[model samples]
Target: MIVVVEGISAAGKTTWCHQNAAQFLIKESYPEKRPDRQAGPGEAARIWTDWNAKRWSDAVAMERAQGVAVCDTDPLKLHFIWAMWQIGEVAESHWTAQLKFTRQALQDQRLGFADHYLFKKIDPDVAQAQKDHDAARSRPNFDLHLRLHASLVVWYETIEKVLSGRLNWELSETLPAAEHTPNPYRYDVSVFDRFIQMLPRPRR
Candidate 1:
């Protein structure tokens, strides 16, 4: 099974992945080259889709070899953009462009929904304390992550509703094993459209 593990900063997701999924883990990465700073929304969307598709492909290869593969984050990360848009951090054009590009990637099978998702939900105060104590990694965006956490949870709730039984909404101390749940809508473009449509509309 392809399992995605996601959490905000200091949520212990990376630590859990390191301990349990070293063999079958696909670490998140950006494209080798950055897009132009002045690129338009469509151009940016195309670039991000390609990058995410590569990650999904890597996860598939790992799962084929090892019987399971764990990803540090969802490769089809449309939620980040939508969540940011939800809070008015970005303009709607960006979300629209990304939806167009990512849905095409799904239709092409370059990107598909994972068989399972594990989320690490933590108390904000505890997460803040953990962030303060972690000296090795400098989480400059920790505050931003805290702000985005609620919106992120809401995003995945919609996903869980749309693709039922595939998401474990909370993570425990140990990684949960995923069953071979046949995802009928894994590559369905209409499901992608529905998922996007279920998102909270961006505020004016």
Candidate 2:
């Protein structure tokens, strides 16, 4: 089962996936693992090329190996992210680079994940609770924060459409609630239990 935990930054997806899934495959999870480079690094392409290659490769290997792989984010989400950046007075070039990196990753099958759970209704109080739990965790990207919340209803609907049309997969924006605290990792066990209940069995 490929279970992807997707949401805005600092939405407790990483925490939730760790608790619920057998394996986790977020981008930062294996920062030391690098793949063979497909594109050359130069002045303009240095940062973008490296980021995409590593992310794409890691995704491919992890998905192939794990039974219950939990991806913290999906590159498809990049479209919204980059758009947010552009609308929030970010450098046009940077936003373009984000889209380019995501496009390359998707084309190479690195960003292709199945069984996504798109978290919705990221309450500010819930976000604050998570922030209090980790000092190193910075605030969500400002542009993304403003853009996603302002248009989440539309964004969520659009994502569902894309999932069906391009990936032939279903998408939902809800998950089992955390029993205590905002840690998503705590919810992984419940997710696995629910999966088991859905399986078929041999005749008695």
lDDT of each: 0.85, 0.46
Candidate 1, which segments miss by more than 4 Å at Cα?
A: 36-38, 173-175
Question: TM-score: which candidate is best?
Answer: 1
Model 2 agreement with the true structure over 94-175: per-residue lDDT tens digits: 5455546645554555444345444445766666676667788666563356455534434444545534422212224333
Instruction: List the pairs of residues colliding in candidate 2.
Output: 15-184, 15-185, 16-184, 16-185, 19-185, 19-188, 20-188
lDDT of 1 by residue, 75-126 (tens): 9988888877888777888888888888899999999998888987788999
- Candidate 1 local Cα displacement, residue 85, angstroms: 0.5
Clashes of each: 0, 7
TM-score of each: 0.93, 0.56
